[model samples]
Target chain A: MKFNLKKMLTTFILFFCSIAFLLPFVWMLSTSMKIEADVFKFPIEWIPSRWNFVSNYQEVWFGDHPFYLYYWNSIKVAVITTLLSVVVSALAAYGFSKVKFRASAWLFLIVLATYMVPPQASLVPQFILYRYIGLFDSHLGLILLGSFSVLGTFMLRQFFMGIHNDFIDAAKIDGAGHWRIFWKISLPIVKPAVATYAILRFIWTWNDYQNPLIFLRTDALYTIQLAMQKFTTINGSFYTLIMAAAVSAILPLLIVFILGQKHVIDGIALGGVKG
Target chain B: MPSNPSIETKTNIRKKQKNASKRRETIAGFLFVTPMLIGVSVIVLFPIVATFILAFADWKFVQSIDNLKWVGFQNFQGLWEDEKFIKSVINNAVFMLTVPTTMIISLVLAILIDKYTYFKSYFKVAFFMPYISSVVAIAVVWQVLFHPSQGPINQVLMSFGIENPPTWISDPNFALLSVMIIHIWISIGFNLIVYIAGLQSIPKELYEAADMDGANAWHKFSNITFPVISPTSFFLLITGIIATFKVFDLIAVLTQGGPLNSTTMLVWHLYDMAFLNLEIGYASAIAVVLFLIVFTITILQWISQKKWVNY
Candidate 1:
């Protein structure tokens, strides 16, 4: 219970560091909601003196070039990709963790080895393949590309191992099939992990700029990030508006993290070394 | 780690499950990973193989498809002569050195937070706040902060009587480092949390034993702490190197490899080559090089883990 000066110094340094880390975000949020005049004043304001939330959010959401479609497109892609990734990765994790087959080890190694392949190496051929198949610029193409996550599969596999295998055996003796063992028993044990991965996957896909930016042609088909970039224009006149757009895009992610961060931290703390 | 007693008790049932179950399970395993296998094959694996094939050919990507200039060894042979790809590789090497320095700093900070009990969770959450938020947002905020005119960063410098700070993201000199700074800030939260876990996993008895030997804090750290946590350091280094190699988002936003391509690394160059110039064949060659570099390094790290990593 003693208050040591060393602990006090550590706490103080951390507080300053946190302030330093959090201030830019605080500045961006304030700037996005401020009047253009207030944005560039000599003395930077951390908070908008007058609240301009309604207009800022409005311009970002329903301006001359509305972000509504972009919002829907991003959300749609993220949701579908998350669902597909979760289902596939959970199954893959289960197979790697629970299913006993002669080929299981090899299959698991292939999956693990696949993670080592960098995605940029795939860009050119995937583009050509998509173009040939006429999946280019299509939402389905984006979803298809985004749906597979080897990292997610590997991460979930680690979690499934942490689960007690007795449940799997108990279910097998009840005449449960492989599917039933996965669905009824294994699924419940790894729900926290699944949820953890889903959050990470959702953030990853939502923030993804490259794939959609390349494949998507129409401004209306844009994700929020791309749409915001277009909204700001390449020339950068609408920089303040760009900040507003950035703020709106980041808002949802911040919410997701604040809500789910405990799980992610716990999962990472427990999960990283083993992997 | 669990055994089914029924597999021992009921031989006939076990044999039936084994025979029929073998086919059923194989099919099920394939079915389970079908989406990932298909998705990964189309988007990742197959494309990679195709890139290697395209390296030896000359497809204009969007142009004439029929006539492929069979340039055997020319593309790769051309790589050594090319300046930009070479520069891109060099920039990547510089980046590789700088990025890990940032992550190491974070690891130290995380250990400090962990060693002190009070408000550890609060510090952990605060440190990680930037990571969960959008990278684009962070870049934009950073652009403003690095603004030569009124940014708090240069502003503080100016107040200290430092004149004419280099224009970050605008000057070719500091652009790559500027981008790395933002990357460090974003990735610190992640690396810090990982190390805190590493610190916790170390046995308290080691420190207790060291204390009985009248070891100072520094001695205890070097003796018991660093070795125990070296595995986490190893993981961070490998992941850091890989992530640095594939880094694209921030560069595409902040500098666009501008200030005259000083910040352009392998993946960014690949993006420019493929999407910008439509030189798919050449870009494929470049991507093929990156894949080889990254894949080789990852394997080497995995092999070397035995020397340092404990658990």
Candidate 2:
């Protein structure tokens, strides 16, 4: 009876904490659909008395800075970056893990060491180099900045190490080259790990504010994050509109989270176990 | 004699083929890693070298390479005297307190949800929502929620008989704290999930043995749970401290180093100096310091891991 009561009490406390934790997002959703006047109605209207959902969303999606353009930009950058990064990291991971070479260990160690250098340390020089190379203020430069991740290579390498050598050896005995073995024999086995990484890379690239904020000078090339900031600044006074913009900015992430929750949880678990 | 010569040549050919195949594999390995190697060399490694070099020099990026002026230790001296830089460093140290606070809360919640709660996934998703959301969006929502008089938080406080609630994000005194609150909130989901993972890894036999021994929950937790999860705590701590230094989006979106520079963190200060003030040399110096601090922290953590972390 005591144990049952204790479980009930803990659950009861957690339930309320969860509500308070989700209050910001809930309030955001509610306020976005609310009319401006109903926004400040004290003893707060959890549900809006007057709904302005259509017009509020319409204004945000097609306002002076059309969010659709920014959305497209973010999608293009994130997709390309994730695809390129995954391919690059996976190939390198395969090489370091499966391919026998004299200097493989040392080279991988060098790559791991570079991961310790903070990105902030290199921002200034990267800015200068991009300008010098005529890649400044372009999506290509921004994509290239995130295209190679030492962490991704190192992470995928760990997964690749788990692949049995007999598989690769059998493929080699059949006259299969390293490339063929990597594509046919090894990658499929680590598809889940790769997918998890791809999702994470996409989300990180999509939400990335600093690179886009620094690299992209043209307003049209702005990602959703920068556009969201600008939208909030212009629509600061209209709480309803700002809330609507905020909702739009995070809607895609929420969708991704819903879809990839299991993978994300597993990835965090992998990290913890490895630690 | 003839049979011996033919056999020796046959073995020699096989050895040569083996060496040739080994060489081929090595070449293929090199080819596989070439792209990543080039990308890292150009994007990451080269830039770090440039940052270190540029830290000792004065030159706006607009200026040509010939215009570079080397001044030994001058940028570091500027950092030593700069009030904003000093305060930003201090603010970052204060901001790091959020990591431990968030970890403790997440741990307790994780233990409850992992063992006691009914709907585990429901709780996990709810907590994690803030973490996955864009910082700009979250910061904007928080701006509304932290509104001086009209916000829900102040409204709740005022209703409870506190006449004046501190205007969070606007007041320099509370700006860092407000940001830290949001930081803690966003971090809980990730930390909670990780702690739950760490918790599940603990062997059930140990807990069962403790139960058999009539060991209380507190004693079991202290003797077993806490020590086992110390590695997770250490991992989170290192990453969390590194992350605190890299906090720019929050500052950029919410306070912009604020009414009194109270929330001016290291990265925000670096951004301000590099981009806004066009003090590239000074900013590079700041980045160098940031790098050293992270390096020192990681090294210290590794050394101290011997004492606390179990595995």
Candidate 3:
């Protein structure tokens, strides 16, 4: 454990670099709280000149647009999607891991293959289908679109397969059904994986811009990402206000990651791609 | 022999336990999985097959299913002659070099952070924070940061006696580069995490052995570190490249294929044709071309894995 000066110097610089990486976000947060006059203050104030920060949020919440509509839409879509995706993935993962069937592998491959198709590739067809089904511009429709993902199913299957057979066999011997075994024995053990998948799906669905952009025509149905996209105009730009909106949109994701970090870290650690 | 009392009691109990639970498992499994299965079939699965077939058909609104006419290779011909489409393909090639270079450097940064013991998660969180945020939000912020005049970046440069920083978003020469910078910045977290994970997988014993052999940090890295992470790097390379090729949202939010269509990547081109111009047949063709390009490159990388992606 000799003290290597080169290593120390590099690490020292990297620490500040990492901080510098965070500087834009810091600046955004500070600027949002600053008075409109101090928005471009020289010497770069890292904190606000003003103590109170309400008018901006006040406008967002109660403006003619009422961004809370966007907020509510985002929450509804994200929650429904996360729950649907997780349950479906968990069930499918358990099936693939435990069930016997002639065409299971083929079916699973088809599922994974769906991930390879770029969403852009399916844009027209999905639009046609949603339009036909009368699900267009509806919240339930948006939820269903975001919820189904093959990647989640594929990722969860690996975790379920890692669960040992002894517990499953014991459950069976005790007359526990597949549902009970899946719920009690399998689900609890693979909770880390389930939690990780949930966080990812939630973040992705929340941050999704493309789907909402295309499917959501009505102003009432806009997600936060879509709202933030339409914030900028060619003339009379509101850079500070948009930055404020941006920060608000990202805050929830930060919260989710903070709460789920341990489970996520364990999940990544289990994958062991680094080794 | 025992068909009376003993057989009757045993038969009843066995039927209840076996059939009851097994029957419940079959029905419950299907019920639990139905939502995803139905969603995937309609939204995801059927779309793939439908889009491919629709690629050959000539339709404007694509509303009347009966009005679709089979126009084999006609749409592809139009896209080939499209000057805008041609420019998009060329732009994609230029973008390819810029994003990957940034990915490599950030990976090095991630590895450095991994080696240092202090502030690991803090650094991880810092590097990864940008990733979880909204792409549209980040793009909008960067749009201001790279503003032509009255922007901090140029202002700081002028303070250092440098002058005339290009208008990043508006300048044709810098527009694609500006997008590339954002792409790289946004991507660093995921790539860093992947690289850091790859780095951690390398055993300490190899470094210990290298130490006994009088090997320095560079020596150990070239031999021990590089080979071990090749698989993860390979994974990132294919996935990142594919992701870059298919990039859309940020470009849509930031430039909209600015000043003179200099920033018109293929996805934007395809999107414009269909939605803006209402040319479904031609747009479908462009999408198919994009798919071919991505699929071919992915397969090439997959093939090269035997040689370069050592695992």
lDDT pick, better of 2 and 3: 2
True contacts kept of each: 0.63, 0.76, 0.44
Off by over 4 Å in 3: A1-9, A50-52, A265-275, B1-35, B62-67
* Best candidate, TM-score: 2
Number of the top candidate by lDDT? Answer: 2
**How many residue pairs clash in each candidate at the backbone level?**
0, 0, 3
Residue range A168-219, candidate 2, lDDT tens digits? 8998889999999999989999999998899888889989999999998999
lDDT of 3 by residue, A1-275 (tens): 46577677777888889888887788778766666677666667677767436877666567666678899989989999899889888888887776644455766777776777777877877877888889888877788887777878878888788878887888888988787888888899988788888988899899999888878889888999888776555213655666677788888888998888766555544443632
Each prediction's DockQ?
A: 0.64, 0.79, 0.47
RMSD of 1: 4.4
- Cα shift from native, residue B171, model 1 (Å): 0.9
The regions of model 1 sitting more than 4 angstroms off are A1-5, A164-166, B1-18
**Which candidate leads in DockQ?**
2
Q: Write the per-residue lDDT of candidate 1 for residues A36-132, one digit (tens) a residue.
A: 6676665667777866777777877787877777889989999998998899889888877877666778767876777888888888888888889
Q: How high a TM-score does candidate 3 get?
A: 0.91
* TM-score (chain A only) of candidate 3: 0.91
What is candidate 1's lDDT per residue for B1-311, written digit by digit as tens?
Answer: 24667566688777876888788877877777666666666677777788899988877866778877878878888889978888899999998875578667887787789886468888888888887877766777788788887776887778788899888889889998898888888888888898899888889999999999999988988888888988888888888888898788898878887788899888988898888888877888898899999999998997899976765
Docking class of 1: medium
